[model samples]
Every structure is written in structure tokens, then in C-alpha cells.
Target: MIETANYTAYFDKARLAGRKLNLAPAVINAILEDVALAAIANTDRILAENQKDLDRMNPSDPKYDRLKLTAERIQAIANDIMDVARLDSPLGKVLMEDTRPNGLNLKKVRVPLGVVGVIYEARPNVTFDVFALCFKTGNVAILKGGSDADYSNRAIISVIHEVLLKHNIDVNAATLLPAEREATEALLNAREYVDVLIPRGSQGLINFVRNNSKVPVIETGAGIVHIFFDEFADLDKGIGIIFNSKTRRVSVCNALDCLLIHKSRLGDLEKITSRLLDKDVELFVDEESFKVIENHYPVHLLHKAEPEHFGTEFLAMKMAIKTVTNLEEALDHIAQYSSKHSEAIISENANNIERFLNEVDAAAVYANASTAFTDGAQFGLGAEIGISTQKLHARGPMGLEELTSYKWIVNGNGQTRDH
Candidate 1:
């Protein structure tokens, strides 16, 4: 159980630690490398603790896959840490500079968003990702991981603290709060210490944080993602992209939830979705698609889609299909139901492709590709803290750069402001 009264002390320590995180770039990289090596060295221990969390969850639960960690996933997390170590730091760079007539030299420079607080669900990998990106960008991290992965998160944080202590760095640089409801409430109210709060989980969790947090929230919106199969879509390409997007990993936010099919392309729906049969993907079909695919798709997996199914994020082997008369209808449906995370169109027509890409208001819009690639590492940013669906501060996959904010630096020699 958490000593809820000590929440303020935790925030205070993290805030102070942020000041000391602006270390030299080389030193930061070295620390990250050590953490990566330590992760590999401690893989056995991490997996053991992760199993403790997994045992509590039923295998059928959507979060079960995310909560379980294996040696391969641990190695992948370690490799991503190494990738972060290799990348150039985004801190201290001059974004913009100007010289005024009054002899005032002004420059906008990149800096960290000090004391980034993340409230996340069962994905313990986020603990490492948030710490690596925040540390690389000279920011402190305060993690409020869900109780589902408490054991795993504690294990991961222990490894990080061991490395930080060895390097004489403050372990408070990456503080993991107690995994309890009281801790979450305290974090939501930590406006004085936490600069920004990021929530990564279901829509309910995101909404709770956004609605309740006194600290500014950067929402990692739940992915109610869609991929439109236009009239000009290539059968082969569409087949591959659609299959990979839905079945690659269903528990992820980027996994395809609703598939929009052009009425003209309804005939090709079976060919496009035939591969999903391998994974026993359950399809919730509309009136039109139901008629076309009812005989083709397995009876056990095929069901008539209700109104609620279109906007739902099915983090499982389930998917919904909607048939649209034209591109305009598809766009309208997406605008109505999309969470604006990742949207894609599989089409060969240049005009239709350009229109879809230009009009869709998603953080990551794709033409002739899978939505599954809506990830920071796939976009060549190593690991990501989360995918920001909001437009104000950051959008899409958040890397080291996204974790930073800019400040204006002004210099003048005896120049006084005249009002």
C-alpha cells in the first residue's frame, strides 16, 4: 500500500532531480548504454517479476499479452535503449534566432519539459521508454504505472535505479510512484511539481486523466483507427496491408479496429480479409458487408456490426467493417468515429490518395501502408513515450524531440525596454 501523504514529497524530489538532469550529452548517452546493458544482464529477473503480473491476468484478457514479457521482448527493449543512446540529443539546439533594431539578440532554444509524469497501464516497457527519452532530452520522469503490472514495473525501476546509483546519478531522476488508486489521484493533483502529464491506456484512463488532472495533460488518445479501401485500391497491396494492420498485434493502439470499404470494392473484401481467417479474426460486418462476406467468412467469427462497433477500439481478434458509397462517405464516417490517432487509405489513384492524406485529421496518416507502423521506433525515433493524438504540444510518435519544449533566450548590451 502507498503512503498517500508522501505523494507531495515524491513530487518535490522529482522536481529537484530535474535540475540535475541537464548533464552533458555524452554522459547521458553513457548512462543510457549502461542501462541497456544492465537490462540484458538482468533479463532473467525482469521476466520472473513480469510473470508474477501475468499469472494474475487471464490469458484471454486483451492486456495479458502486453503485461507478459519474454527474453526476446527484453532484448528488444534493451536494443531500443541502445538506439536512443546513439541518437543525437534534442536539447540546447537553437530553433530560431533574430536580431532586432534595438540591438536585442533573441533566440529560441530547445529545452526539456521538466518533470514529465506518465500514467500508463499494463505495458511495463513504457517505464524504460519514458525514462530513456526523458533522460536523453534532459527531463525527469515520474511514472504512475497501473497495478496490473506492479511487479514488472517495480523490477524495471529497480534495474534503472541500480544503474543510476552506480553512476552517482540521482535515482529520483526516474521515480515510479506506488501502483495504487491513491497514487494516481495524487499524481493528477501534482500541478505544482509536474510540468505535464501523459496518459497511455484505454479511452477511459485517458479521459480520467484529462478530466481530473490539475497538471496539463498530453493525451495519448486511444486508437479508434480505420483504413479505407478505396475504389482504386490494389488488391495485392490492400490484402497485405489490411492483414498486417489487423493481426500483426491486436492489443496495440495502432491495430485496425474499423475497416472502411468502398461499395465498389466490396467484391474484393473476401480476398482482402482472407488472411485474417488464419488468426480467426472476428468480423462485425455492416448490413452490406454482411451480405457479401457472410457466406465467405466463418459463421463463428462473422456477426452483424452494431452502431457501437464502428467507434469501438477492439483490442482483440475482433474488427468491424463498414461499406461506404464513395470516398466522401468513408471520410465522413471516419471523422465521426475516429479518435484521430492513425488513419490510412489503400489506393493507387493519386488524386484519391492525395485527398485522403490531406483531409484526414490524424496524427499519422498513411497512403498504401499499414497503420501498425504508427510507432516511434518504426519511424526511426528509437523508443517512444506515447503517441500524442493532440495537436497543441506534440503529435504522432513522441521521441526525444517531442519530450522537449522551447524557451526564448534574449541578450542585449545595455538595451532597455521602452513602453
Candidate 2:
């Protein structure tokens, strides 16, 4: 319901605050500790606000789980904030140094990326994550959360602002823009103020941001994730891994969306997906997989696959199953349909695993494990802005180090270049 007439004011403030943020590591940690404590202390209030947002959405919607926050989820978010506070600050670390023959010393040191503007949907936890990760790196945060979670996002931002005000830090250092579409448009065009824009949401949202934004965009791509059940795959491992990958948290980006089984392993398909039955997972299966799973899986939840089913990121308890003749066919299928988010191969054969890991073009490649492990906290980076699928700046879970860029520092005493 809140709208800003001049969103540029927010961007300007963030840019200025970013340029001025040079606190000592201890100060930053102290502030972050206060924020974490504040979040936990305000648990009830955050929940109450979160409930308002949840009430507006259908519970059956895939984003409902992502939008709704509980006491335990809030506690986990606070823990991640503390984890970020405890990690070593990457700023000022000399990445490279050289002494030139011209009596000049040169060094490249890590620095913040300045103003990081994140446009995301539904997930209110991203507010805390963007703040924690950006603040840790001395980068300013300007978040534009979706309208669906506006109330929850606003509540979380207020807690952060309370802590910032207590520390006499500029509240604008972490700004949450209005949850209106206009705010998103303003943010997309603010290239002068925002160093980078990271979009975390559906493929449609990511694509929209990438195609339209004037600001340099870091694509946190949608996961049209897949896992291949190789002929040599251990059936025991394949069963458990696929189950967890699809059912552990279906709303997450890393949750499995497609399963590729070797033609020889088609017999084992029913057994592999046996656990998904418990979750009532809907399967869009190819002819081979459908024939194998026809009467095995719940008839109500099974359907023959269409061309559209192959590349879809079903952020629900729905998945697609394809039958590949060999490793090459599996690889080709994934290469065609994958969003390059996460890809996996379940196999005991060392050669097959190596080939899959090396040849699979994705942000993360797994061997005999669930793609669900593709996360920042699981990777030990505390929290992440998003999993970048692009090749330029960052790829995979963007952690503290990924939030930084290097600047060259040169020390010279009247040493000038002469031709």
C-alpha cells in the first residue's frame, strides 16, 4: 500500500551511505550482533506481520511456504546473520601485489561492490540475508520486496533500522523500497546509484530484470534442475537422494524439477520414485518412464510429459521424468533444458561421475547427492544473495567473497610512465 513518489531519493541516499561506510570489523560485527538479537527479540511481532501477508495468499500456492515465516524460521535467519557477523571480513584483503621496476608499488585489494539493489519476490528472509551479507561487505542494500510479503518485509526492515539507529548508522544504509511495481521500475533504471542488481524469484522475474534493467544485472536464475540416474548408479543412493532433492523443500530453487533415468535403469524408475509417492508428487513422465511408472505411482498424480514439461521449474511437488539412452543422451537433454542452476548425476562409476561433473554446464554439479544441497549456508558462506547462473561476475551461491570486487592501489613517489 505504500508508494514512494521519488524512489531516486532512496537510491541517492544508499549510494552516499555506501561511499561513507568504512567501519572497523569489530564495529560491523557488533552492529550485526545487535541486529540478530533484535530479530529474535522481535520474533512475535515479525510473525504477526508475516501472518498478515500469509493470510492473503492461498496456502496451496508454492510461494506460500516461502512467504510464511515461523518462530523457528526466524531463529534460523538470525543464526545465519550471526554466522555472517563471525566470518572474516573480505574487505581490504590484498588479492594481488607487485613491485614495479619504476619504484612503484601496486596492490589489488578487495572492496565492496557499493550499492547492491536486490529485487525479489515472496521470500521475506531475503531481507535479512541481503542486509547481513551486504552490511558485512560494507555494501549498501536497497531491497524491493514483492507485494506479497510487503508487511513481513517491512516488519523485518524496521527491526534492522532500530538497530542501525541505536548505532547511529544511517538507516538509509539498508533501505526497503515500496512494494509497488513503480519502485521496481525506478530501481531498474538507477544505474548511477546501484552497482549491481540481483533478482531472486521466478524465471520470468529474472528474465524481466535481465532484459530490461539499465543497472548491471547478476542473474540468480530459476532452477530447471535435473538429476540423471546413471546405469551404474547405486539404487539405494539414487532412491534416497532423489527423494530428498524433490521433497525436502519443494519451494526452494535447488529442489529437483526433472529426473533423467538411463534406459537400462528404467526398470528401477518405479523404485527410485517410490518415496515421492508419500509426498503425492505429480510426475510428468516421458513414454518410457510413464510405461514403467504407469500403475506404480499414484494415477492421480501421474501424467504423460509434453514438450513444455521438460524445461519447467515446477516450484511445487511436481516433477518431470525423462528416459535417456546413455550418458551422452542424458547430458544432451540437460544441456537443452537446464537453466544452468543445478545439475546432478547419481553413479558409482568414477568415470561417469567425472564426466558428468566436468561436462555439466551449471552453477552446481552434484554426484550421488541431492541438488537440495545447493545453498549458501550449506556451502558455509553464511547466507547468499542468490545463486548466480551467469558467467561474468559470479556463478553459484554468492557469498561474502562473491559480494566484493577488487580495486588497484598504487604507491608511487613521482614515478611517471615515459615512452
Candidate 3:
């Protein structure tokens, strides 16, 4: 049981230790390497434990399948850790150095955010990702993963703690909360202990964490991604991008949730819509789009999209479809409905592409590319803690640098401000 007093004491000690360690880049890199190797070594055990969890869970549960880890998934987690270690460390670097004419020397240096509380659901791989990113930035992390994958998460955390202990590092640096909802609630309210709270999962979970947590939060907006196919779009590329975005990996945060085709391209909508149907994607088409493809395909008529659908992050094989009059209309629709997570414009017109890229307020805006590329690994940041849709702190796939904050260090020769 994590007593409130115990948590407070642990946090104070952690902060003190963090100050003392002043972890250098080389030390951070070495620790990451060790953890990666440990993760690789324990892949078999992680998979077995995950399978056990899956067997006990109801197959109908949405998270049951997502929580299950295979050998390949375990290997992928190890790879992500190694990738994070290869990236540049974001600690102790001098961001700026300057001296005033009054002989005051000021230096801004990058520093860790002390302690990060990561609350996530389903995916057990997040355990490794959060540890790698946080430890690399010299921040201690307290993970509170969903209960569905409790056993698997426990196994992975045990290996990480063992690795930390082997290197004489504090094992509490990578702590896991008790597998209980009440424990999570307690942690959320423990604002004095946790420095920042990052919730990664469904919209509901993120909302709950944001609303309930007393600690500062970096909202990783749930993805309700969209793809707009302009009249000038290359049919081949647009169709391919849309299909891949919707079907490549439907069970991710960045999968395409909606597809918008220009009304001028209504003739081609049937062909593209047919292909999506082949992949079992449920289409919710607007009046114009329905009129164009209704004869050829069976689709659910969407008279009006609910406000919820506009911001909904459906991590499944479902998508909404609409037809716009012009590029302006499309852009307006996107601005109104988008989650500001990821939006794509498939147009061969350079002006349209440039406009979309510049005007869209999102973490990632794509031109001719699929919305699926809005990933940390794909963005070449190694691994991500989470994708921040908010403008403050971190705005996209948060890697090592986003895990840190800045502090100004002053060197003075008995300089005092005269009131």
C-alpha cells in the first residue's frame, strides 16, 4: 500500500537524490543501454506473462487484445529503448550563456522535471518507453498502467528496477503504482509528490487524469486524425495514402478517423470507398458523398456529425467521410472538427500543400504523406513519452528534450540587487 506520507517522503528523497546525482549525459546513455539489454533479456518472460493476462481477460474487451504482447512486440520494445539511448541526451546542456554590462553572468541550463507520473492504458510497451525517455532526461518516473495488463507491467518494471539496482542507481527512479484504481486516484491527488502528470491512452482516460490530477499536466490529445483529398490530388497517391492510413494499423492513436474528398472528385469516391470497404472500414458519409457512392456501395448516412465524433479518437476500423466544395471549405471543416493531433492534405498543388502545412493547427500536418507518419519513431526522435497536442511545454512527439525544463544559473561576485 502506498501511504500518502510514504509517497511524500519518497518524493522528497528522490528530489534530493536527483539534485545530488546531477546525472551527466554519459551516465544517462549508459543506464539506457543497460535497461535496453535487460529488456531484451526478459522478452520471453514478458510475453508469457502478457499471454497469461490475455487468457484470463474476456476476449470481447477492447483492451484485452491490445494488451497482449507477443515475441515481436517484446523485441520492438527493446529496440525502442536502444533507439532512445542513441538519441542526444537533453540534460545539463547550456541553452544560453550571457553576461550583462553590470558584470552579472547568467547561464540557462537544461534540467530534468524531477518526477513524472505517467498514467497509461492497455499497451504494456509504454512501461519501457516511459522509463527510457524519463531516465534519459534524468527525471524519475512513477508509472500507473491500466489493470488489464497489470501482471505484464509488473514483470517489466521488475526487470527495469533490477537493472537500475545493478548499476547502483535508485530503483525508485522507475517505480510503478499498485494495480488499483484507488491507487491511481491517490497518485493523481498527490500533487506534492508528482511533478507532472502525463496520461496516455483513450480520450476518456486523458480527460479523467486532466480533470482530477492536482499536478501539472501535459495533455497528450487523443488523435482524431483526418485526410483531405483535394480536387488537384493525384488519385493514385491520395487513394493509397487514405487506404494505408485507415488500414495499415487501425489500433493506434494516429490512425485515420475521417476522410474528406473534394466534391469535384466525387466520381472517384466510389472506387476509393469500395477499397476501404474491402478492408472492413465503416464509412460515415455526408449527403454529397452518399449521393455519389450510394448506388455502388452501402454506407451509413450521416445527416450531421455529432460534436463528439469531431473530437472522437476511434482506435478501431471506423472512419467518417465527407465531401467539401473547395479547399477553403475543407480547411474550415478541419479547423472546426480536428483534434489538432494530425491532419493530412493530399494535393499535387504546391500552393495548397504549403497552405495546409502552414495553416493547420496540429502537432503534425502532412502533405501528400499519410497521417500515420505522426509517430515518434517515424519522426526519428527514437522513442516518445507521448504526443503533446497542446502548445505549452511540448507540442508533438515528446522525446528526451521534452522531458526536461530549463533553469537559469547565475554566477555572481557578491552582486546584490539594490532596492
TM-score of each prediction? 0.98, 0.98, 0.93
lDDT of 3 by residue, 1-419 (tens): 44566456556665655554567677877888888888788888887888878888887565765787877777777788888888887677899999997788999999889889899988888899998988888888888888888999999999998988887887878878777887687778778777899999888899999888888999998888989999899988988999999888777778998888888898999788777877777766677777777677653532344445555666776788877888898899889878889999999999999999999999999999888888888888888889899998899898888999999999988888889
- Per-residue lDDT tens digits for candidate 2, residues 1-419, read 32333676888788888876899999999999999999999999999999999999999999999998999999999999999999999999999999999989999999999999999999999999999999999999999999999999999999999999999999999999989898998888887779999999998899999998989999999999999999999999999999999999999999999999999988888787788898989999999889888988878899999999999989999999999989999999999999999999999999999999999999999998889989999999999999999999899999999999999999999997779
Instruction: Give me candidate 3's TM-score against the actual structure.
Output: 0.93
- Residue 84 in model 1: shift from native, Å? 1.0
lDDT for each residue of candidate 1 in 305-405, tens digit (9 for 90 to 100): 88899899999999999999999999999999999999999999999999999999999999999999999899999999999999998999999889989
The model with the greater TM-score, 1 or 3, is 1
Distance from true position, residue 305, model 2, in Å?
1.1
| Per-model C-alpha RMSD | 1.5, 1.8, 2.5
Score candidate 2 by TM-score against the native.
Answer: 0.98
Full ranking by lDDT:
2, 1, 3
Q: How accurate locally, in lDDT, is each candidate?
A: 0.93, 0.93, 0.83
Deviating ranges (above 4 Å) for candidate 1: 1-5
| Residue pair clashes in candidate 3 | none
Among all windows of 10 consecutive residues in model 1, the one with the lowest summed lDDT is 1-10
